[model samples]
Target: MGLHVFGHDPSGDTALSERALIEAVDVLIFCAPIRQTPAVISHYVAQAAGIEREQLWLDITSIKAVPVAVMLTSQAEVVGLHPMSAAPKAATLRGRSMVVCEARLDKWRPWLEDFLAATEADCVRADAEQHDRIMALVQGMVHATHMAQGAVLRELAPAVGDLDGIRPFSSVGYELDVAVTRRILASNPAIYQDIQFENPHVAPMLERLAAHLDTLRDLVRQGDDEARDRMRETLLEQSRAYVGEQAIAEGSYAFERLGYLLADLHEPRYISVFLPVDRPGSLRALLSVFEQRGINLDSIHSSRSADGDLLFRIGVSRDGDTLALRSAMSAIEAEGIGRVVDAPG
Candidate 1:
């Protein structure tokens, strides 16, 4: 744990011999831009480059098959790591998903497993090929569909209404879809660009998605009972049959839970607080202030602010007296439990 870590730019020269410096380290992790990733690892971590058998080479990239394959060409113990979420405000990947592809691990397997366990992530083991294929569905198809939805909304905004104007008339499903679409549109384009193009499996997945959409469109255009029966048979019956009972039940339950959370978040009355301490009972102590004041809370959620502070956002019921809620917030700050921040809109 006390080991000093150094960052070296592979393209740039060091004053001392570059090969000497590289050969000195026990681990070499590749974190360059996506397209140049394979070339960088392949160049530096090769068996001919004096990389030792005990050395570990890891890469934290989205796609795995190619990079892990290239890494295996090295004599070093090779591993491919993919954290399945964006860089979080919190330090560790606790409660999030991570993919671990152990291509050629032998000497460093125990150490790698320990390091991953310390991160508290929900780790899934996959071979490189399987990882790429599943990710094509989990990431690629999901992003593509939402991007398409965003485009359709943009195209119709002039004829229908803009996001803000349409909000008043939106149903739960529409609102949820719009939130996801807007989130994808708001983020950097390059991440999505690579997910869509870099993975070989994504193109085929998109074709399948397009085929289904096209069939739905045709069925709708027919506008008859026969068309309705066909739609039910192809879309609902086949999908439900293939998806199985348990998964369908869980997915439907998840949707209902999301719907409830969304409704509470949209409520007008809310208070956002940040607890400075990082220990047990911090949240409970903060909640007690509201309990003592007899204010009814609709919902409570934890999220990270733009400035990277963890915020506990409380949605208040409409019946909650504003003055009483304000009094409780002031008490919380005065007692050094937490600080009240401006509630998100």
Candidate 2:
């Protein structure tokens, strides 16, 4: 039997109308939209006063401070969670980050940890104020930068093709930006709207982002040796120094890894396969087919298909034997392990 759920829709602008959501569960999580989050929590809190049980309250919003504060108004244990990722297409949040803010936790900390553990997310704890301040740069400035890039690209669509059409000439940086911009555009506009407008720190953060951009524009116009030196000093050297060496090293390594992945993805010689069974040894069995055929993979990445199948994209080396790759695909299907959804012609 399926588990009964009692939360309001995250996409909805309205607050919870039902009191059962408050009385029915030990934890009242308001998944409602950001603009209406307070009202939703208020509805729960007003009804919650009559109940005697000490419950827990949590929210999964991007910005935490306001929600955490509102949640604190209740007599319940309060915590705010921010899953720093686009919605998951898979079951687990293993590779994704989940920020936890302990606002009024006493008995709820263990419960929160248990819940987080089940999600398999990389959990980090911070206070509500600290979380919002950092999100100002991470979410606000970053989103604004891409949004501006998207608008500029939209304007240039008449000369160059829009996002899809411009991909043929996209550098790795441009390609990555395009992907992020597309993701933001595709999601609910309200979420982005609230992130920019609601977070108190965002407005000031945007000003700093704009100032740096304006400085960059002026430096490019000057196009002198002094301008070049100033650009490096302000944009590169000083910023790098402030960022710290450990962070710089980590970020540099991450970029290299992504670069390698992108290079493999761009390869023309690759095959997309999907295993039917959702069990252990399925992937091992599939990989063994390639290994047996002496087909060395250039890159192997997993993603979900349109129908929610676990699809694996395997990139073959340019100098590798195409016949072996074809045989491997056939073997996978014949062994009743997986089917090749895509392969080079």
Candidate 3:
């Protein structure tokens, strides 16, 4: 990956203007913010009009419709990309997803796919309109829901202290709601606003959401169990139709898994060991085995045994080297310090 990458900041260095930079590169990629993407792309595209048609132009904007449309006007081959992740982390891109909208691809398709494969990122090809449509629901509706929750919570809780105190008594679901709300609120407002406003499908989706909320309120107020049951059944049936019965079943299982994963008490488990707490420094000695082997323990809990001896439960996450964990566990057992109680499937 001996790639020479250059950054062109408008205010920082006026020597290499955007137009000059675009003319110099084989591929011009616009990684500007969502709101500024279309404008930035347009300005560069105008300069690129007289350039060779073989030049490839791309944008990695969250909202694809506008930038894709602008890029289409240029003489260069246009490819709209949206990496379904934040900025690059380290040199590896494994487990990351990149969306590609081939507005006008020729040879650029294979080149782009090969480049993504080298980074080990999953590339998904979609039409520009389809991508924007899905994003409207995926991003726009989701953000709006969180924003609304934040608004209501601000009115109800009113203070940071209240939120901190409420956390101890709240369920994982409530905690997740607050987390999502806060995550959205913490981001740049203009980005979210552009996502919600630029997508034409979002307004209608919001309207439908409003209507659904109103209907649910009415149903709750009526206190009619029969009507509520009927509504629930209808909604479930519609959901099954939309996503298929198998998907519904899988979604339920995923929800349960998510609940367990999100729980404060649940540690990422590769191995769980039960150690005797009666001996002085037994816990420290047990942990030292793992430490010596370079295996990290995520959490350790202690409780009194029925026989009056103390029991220590040590947990290690899957991220710890598996071979090292096994070796450490064997050493602990051989030393008469602990027994491996459970190992992750």
- Best-fitting candidate, measured by TM-score? 1
Stretches of candidate 3 exceeding 4 Å from the true structure: 88-90, 158-161, 264-288, 291-345
Q: Rank the candidates by TM-score, best first.
A: 1, 2, 3
Clashes of each: 0, 0, 0
User: Which scores better on lDDT, 1 or 3?
Assistant: 1
- Candidate 1 lDDT over 120-157, as tens digits, reads 89999999999999999999999999999888888987
Which of 2 and 3 is the better model by lDDT?
Answer: 2
Each prediction's Cα lDDT score?
0.85, 0.85, 0.77
How do the predictions measure up, each by TM-score? 0.92, 0.90, 0.74
Cand. 2 TM to true fold: 0.90
Screening candidate 3 with a backbone cut-off below 3 angstroms (N, C-alpha, C), the clashing residue pairs are none
lDDT of 3 by residue, 84-189 (tens): 7755433545678888898887887788777778878788889889998899888888899999988877788756557777776787678678878887887788
Candidate 1 clashing pairs, residues 3+ apart or interchain: none
Candidate 3, which ten residues in sequence have the lowest lDDT sum? 303-312
Per-residue alpha-carbon lDDT of candidate 2 for residues 1-345, written as tens digits (9 for 90 to 100): 133666556457245545655776788777767778888778767877757148888898888888888888888888899999966878778899999998888887777787888889999999989999999989998899999988998788768666667778778787788889988899889999999998999999888889999999999999999999999999999999999999999998998888888888889999999888778888899889988978888889988876678999998888988788878888889989899999999
Worst 10 residues of 2 by lDDT: 1-10
**Model 2 segments more than 4 A misplaced:** 1-4, 9-17, 160-166, 306-308, 319-324
Report the C-alpha displacement of residue 68, candidate 1, in angstroms.
0.9
Q: What is the TM-score of candidate 3?
A: 0.74
